[model samples]
Target: MPTGPTIIGFDADDTLWHNEPFFRMTQERFAELLRDHADPDHLMERLLEAERRNLGHYGFGIKGFVLTMIETAIEVTDGRVPASTISHLLNEGREMLRHPVDLLPGAEDTVRQLSQTHVLIMITKGDLLDQERKLAESGLGDLFDGVEIVSDKKAATYTRAFADHGDGAQAGLMVGNSMKSDVIPAIEAGAWGVFCPSEQEWALERADPPVAAPRYHEIASLHELPDLVKTL
Candidate 1:
């Protein structure tokens, strides 16, 4: 018999650990390197646009980002960029690979406590290899009974995930940083959605507010979740 929520889905990137900060850092460096010729904000906008367009093709993660940077460099520079720019991009890619993996303040412990009561699932969208490595390194891999690495998070993604976990839409809750990808979609699929806002934003386009949000709740920290679940 299910005691708490039957299924709990978590977003892995910024929700689980530090993700966007690294991207922002890399972007800033990219801008500084190209500041002599181009506007940083415009360059960032272009890069983000490219990433959005390529979401289906490359998915999310450092590798896709690196590729986008390379492509953006080529496009913006019209192949006039020197070898040093290419080398800098390559070095940044390597740095992304080497960045330390640190779990969010309450992520590990919160997951541990929740795992004991509910069926925990990690439903993240990103590059396959990097996500796998992060999960393995985060030391929370075994805590989740199910792990899903998806290319995108939408209504379809959540619907498939809920079905796959045998939750069948009932007693399902999604916890994550994005209101667009995680909260709205999961709630639309007949699951409860808990939005935990992060400092970083995921997409260039924001998700429209749900027409009906009876099952949606937003919390500040993961530590507050277990208790909230008990009340729901």
Candidate 2:
């Protein structure tokens, strides 16, 4: 009956299109705006701390990042950070929101080809509206059988997603750049996990991969995905 993955999960953001570069650009601006209060290195550290601490409250995406930047600015400056710096940070976030979605090479083709044989589910975590906007703009939105913009990627999340959308986790596969969020959780949920490393991923997303897992796999990029899926 089932040969390989009947349900394929694709991670958005860095996997489908460009994402980290915008965040990096905004971080640069954030550091420049706060240069007077803290050096770039120290300010970035504080920003990261704020992001890590605020994830539970803010969840994820541009809006939360802006809030973290503003919070970090006030903290690093001892509440002396100027309103103009805060305003600049806000504008930078808006720019990130407005940035065009640039799909990774062959990302569309891979999704399209796979959709011919497998049910494709987009499982990504971020601000709901922002994720929707990016997907709508990327033109790959119509290709996915279903879309899931969850708050976080966990084993339970993948288990439910695969169960609802396909035969079950055993017949599903998750492909993404994050070892922590995409690969690890999918494998834990009993689906295949395909690691597609991007040019740059967030430090928080890094994890020692599940190399010993019989279902775990690593690919150079999303372009390699369709062929690999054929073998799975």
Candidate 3:
């Protein structure tokens, strides 16, 4: 494999490390707390609805997650919830915050390999402090020459990344699990994209399939990336 693009952007959450499982654990505990007031499935649905609606107001991270649990408790329990339950919810949210970070298998090796031939950047979106902490703990922080931890990975971010990094489209590629956030914007900005799907990315966060001649490649694993890069 030969170098495909000079600059390759990788997503950080589930794409590079373990993330969604912690959120799912918190949600399950939330349902348990509210089970007396509502069915578990109904509680989950309502909680998800609140999260979607509150994303604009609260954004992502522990703060938004706490609000979702509080709001869900009030809604399902008709504001009659025990004070202890609120305490429990807060504790759970904090526990979510303290969950130890771990990287996906082979992430370090794959990133290291890709870095040998191409410039590597970590392009991730999340609460600033939490994202930074995770990156620091991953032990691959030094591997990335540049890191873009933004609130969103929209078209403008991709454009800036390309322009700031090098000459133009030919030099950049975006790789990640979310098609919506990672691939589409990169492609729209005239950069190549590599899609590596994860089981738990937000469905709405996915990018639609390319409408024009393909400017992206879909891969199964980061370990397969060396071969992909060779062909690029």
Candidate 4:
């Protein structure tokens, strides 16, 4: 464990549990709901645009996504969208909120094992209430030394989090699916950044890997994390 991190941070959503796929499913339903108004590909583009525009206003989470869907629906249909369609979208959002948390393969075991030697923290960005619910449902809440639910992930954010919770950013490592929100910024903040790519990543979270960084690492699954901690 020589030169190992003093703290390890994990991202929620698609990192530890199934998330993007629910959004994907809901979006597919949305496209079907408005199929008469626009083609599926074009509708997806409009929805993506709406999400980009609305991120600052609504932030990230199911709530923001659902709102963006409604906004996109209105824009694409020129405000002629039926009230019933809107109602159906609302129900879809509610269903997503109520969806059971499904932990990713090896997620629970990874966290449980790492929590033994390192000060483990869950640093994620999303709706506060919804995130809290997922963590509670995840049954791994007690394993974490800390949990940070922030509006966004940035270099300053990781610096503050690791400083407050452990030795500092220099002794921290963040593992997650997003190169943008999880890996790049954490490395920029002076912590090790481990990228564990997810199956259903959102486009906004995609970014080029920090291939030349000394502290950057990539693993195909959470199953590889413990050995990573040992080596680092």
Global lDDT of each model?
A: 0.84, 0.91, 0.82, 0.95
- The total number of steric clashes, by the backbone 3 Å criterion, in model 3 comes to 5
Candidate 2 versus truth, CA RMSD in Å, comes to 0.7
Tens-digit per-residue lDDT, 1-232, candidate 3: 3445778888998889988888878888888888889999888888889988988888767778888889989988889989999999899877877777888876899999888877888889878888888989888898888888887778789889777765555678888888888888888888888888877776457557675636778888788877877776
Candidate 3: worst-modelled 10 consecutive residues by lDDT: 204-213
Name the regions of candidate 2 deviating beyond 4 angstroms: none
Q: Candidates' TM-scores? A: 0.93, 0.98, 0.92, 0.98
Best by lDDT: 4
Q: Give candidate 2's TM-score.
A: 0.98
Clashing pairs in 4: none
Off by over 4 Å in 1: 1-4, 203-205, 208-212
What residue pairs are clashing in model 1? Answer: none
How many Å off is the CA of 146 in candidate 3?
1.1
Which segments of candidate 4 are over 4 A away from where they belong?
Answer: none
Worst 10-residue lDDT window for candidate 4 reads: 1-10
Give a tens-digit lDDT track for model 4, residues 1-232: 4477999999999999999999999999999999999999999999999899999999999999999999999999999999999999999999999999999999999998888888999999999999999999999999999999999999999999999999999999999999999999999999999999999889898899999999999999999999988898
Residue 190, model 3: Cα distance from true site in angstroms: 1.5
